[model samples]
Target chain A: MDNLNIGRHISGQFNEDLENVINHVMHMGGLVEKQLSDSLKAVYENDKELAQKVLASDYKINNLEVSIDDECTRIIAKRQPAAGDLRLIMAVIKTIADLERIGDEAEKIAQVALESFDSKQQDLLMNLDNLGRAVLQLLQQTLDAFTRMDVDAAIELHKADKNIDRNYDALMRQLMTYMMEDPRSIPSVMSVIWSARAIERIGDRCQNVCEYIIYFVKGKVVRHTSPDDM
Target chain B: MDNLNIGRHISGQFNEDLENVINHVMHMGGLVEKQLSDSLKAVYENDKELAQKVLASDYKINNLEVSIDDECTRIIAKRQPAAGDLRLIMAVIKTIADLERIGDEAEKIAQVALESFDSKQQDLLMNLDNLGRAVLQLLQQTLDAFTRMDVDAAIELHKADKNIDRNYDALMRQLMTYMMEDPRSIPSVMSVIWSARAIERIGDRCQNVCEYIIYFVKGKVVRHTSPDDM
Candidate 1:
């Protein structure tokens, strides 16, 4: 091939690598979202099987993170792309961290559910499920932003995280009220609180991913920066 | 220069760059620690000036973050160092994010202090100061780990974060109790709860830095892996 065509061939391979990495990320995201969804249902219905599934999938998620991390390193070593390509690699590394944390959160949720299996705290489970749904929505939005490379959508996810925070706070207050009214509710309420906190953390991780998308696309650190301010 | 001398020259320059990055990180660490310290004292003693100082210094800390970020990026772009050097750059970038977030948390504490300017929540402030001290110690340990590149110390910081989590839970319980007893304590107690949460977040950020240190030296992700397990 001529020099120009050689350059085109390399660029084609680079884009292919990017696609593979992004595909892996989306697959991992889907698994994590399923884990969250199932873990919440497990908690609500006391379905130990679903909870165990979520816990088991954590190892898979961890493996995916390691593989993706290795892929990122290999891509840089092999392609030696600069500037924007480098930033995309950096974003992949960061996105892996966030995705792995989401897996951990899912595992934590399962563990909490398993612990609360014998309790008559279905109400607390309902609250946790609600929190999980809100967090799941945030994660979905964040993943969408990454897939589309939509900075505005990523910003929207960042803004939506504040609502999750507010919801978390309200859930905490409700749990506190339940626990104070009846000390017998303490253990169950505390478990739910832990789950809510974990889900809220998942939301935070999603927002972290959203911030990475913005940074990946625009080289801006918009983590704590509000959308209106930006 | 011969290849041997060239090797030594690169090594020396590499060490010097590492030192510069470490020093900048330490300076940022110290600034964040002081901001946390002063913000706690400001709340406890109702020192508005101290709070204002903490808030004002945040701009400098933020500027420092951008500068350090630039230096690390510049090193990576110019040197294109491989293996450990590449890992160091990655770790420094991640560390800067954690340190910047710690600064954000300090700013948050200062904002809370400023908002509660006329409030009389001395008892809550006392608890928050205790919690803040705990977080500062965590930050200190994280900094020591970074300076020494001590994986064991980093592991210890990761484990120590659990203690901060427990302390935050206790604080949350105490605040709930106060709010339950007297509904009027809701607003002030809520502020105290948030301040304590912000300080706890700093501790978490410190642990995150420690995790990056582990990745820096060992090239491993300890997200779901506990220190004992490691």
Candidate 2:
């Protein structure tokens, strides 16, 4: 399709500008999730090439984020959408940001992997891999809820965050024990700890996305509380 | 002066539109610093009234952030700024986001303080107070650096983050020891630990702001690097 035709199609098919915004967010989400998965795999396999690919792709993600953000601004300026649509558009804009940061975090993890490519921290790296997988699962679920506008799924993701937190706490303790047992493992273990913390934070970002989804759908500030509690 | 005259005067007085964006960002930096200060101080003192004040003022901070971001976007679109101006505008935008999140983190801490207002976790609360002070100091310094466009200050703030990290690790250990020592303290200590972690993460956010400042001024990436090393 030509640019003019494409613009007309988007403007005509979508009842509100929010539909276009949501579509762009979903597109960004898909790319970011792929970045997360590939980066984690690269770290696990110690594949520098894959890590490089993730890093290179970050530029594209950054560009996409800027474009989506600009579009959100335009819509907010022109349409002044309200209620559910307004919240959803705002949430999509906010979630796109969180997703972009998640991509950056993945790139940072990949960079760390590249740094310690030949290190003897295989066990710690595997722990990070596990944490990354948990984060990926959370992001996938969060995105699903966002796309479907499923408040229940969003709530579930928020509760599931505690599980990631518990796992992260365990990982920290295990690393602390390793550091305490052998001072030699302190530096290497510290890097692994940072990566695990990064992954855990990515999980938190996903939860934030889920929270936004719930807010978009329900108009409730259900932060720092469980869905069941709400 | 009339509105048009005032606009023309300022437009002619400033060297570049980037300066206006940077100045607006500094305004946001000032606001966020106040928010962080009051929010943490309210937590430290168990001042429910002050916490309420922080909560109420947060909307203003959020609004200021939106304005700053809108200003940055306008500058970017109008001037298509490149090189230093581009990086600076981008940095300001990112810093606004970080500052906004820091405000949210501080609000979260204040919420916990409000929740445990009548609780019996004095020691844990005291540790949280210490952590809050440390994190606030780092945030203040980082914001000051951005205000002054001082790369050295930003670097110094980066080095100081290690202290916050060390404090966080120590706090985690203390919280875990408390939890193990007295199961009864688990709930309260856990809450305090989470607040402390949030505060430390706020310090990390300040570090990110500092990194962005460096990127703005020097067009360099300084993540995962220390001031001394750099």
Judged by DockQ cut-offs, is candidate 1 incorrect, acceptable, medium or high? incorrect
Report the lDDT tens digits of candidate 2 across residue range B1-230. Answer: 01111133235533455556666677777777787788778777878898888888777767777677656555544544445555665677678878888888878787765766334567677777888888887877787777777887878888888898998889887766665565545456556766886788798898888888777677666654546667
CA deviation > 4 Å runs, candidate 1: A1-16, A108-128, A162-187, B1-19, B46-49, B52-63, B107-128, B155-201, B218-223
Q: What is the C-alpha lDDT of each candidate?
A: 0.76, 0.72
| Tens-digit lDDT string for candidate 2 (A1-230) | 01112243234533445556667788889999998899899889988999899988987777777677667655544554445545555566678778878988888777766766335568878888888898898888888887887887778788898899999999887876665565545555656766787798898898878877776677765554645785
Let me know the DockQ for model 2: 0.08
Worst 10 contiguous positions by lDDT, candidate 2 chain B: B1-10
Candidate 1 per-residue C-alpha lDDT over B1-230 given as tens digits, one digit per residue, 9 for 90 to 100: 01111234346877677678878888888887788778877877777888889888887777888788768766766666676667767778778878878887887787766765334457777778888888888888788788777888888778888888998899888877766666555556666766887888888788878888888778786755756777
User: Judged by DockQ, which candidate is best?
Assistant: 1
Docking tier of model 2: it is: incorrect
Clashing pairs in 2: none
- What would the TM-scores of all predictions be? 0.78, 0.59
Note each model's CA RMSD in angstroms: 5.4, 9.1
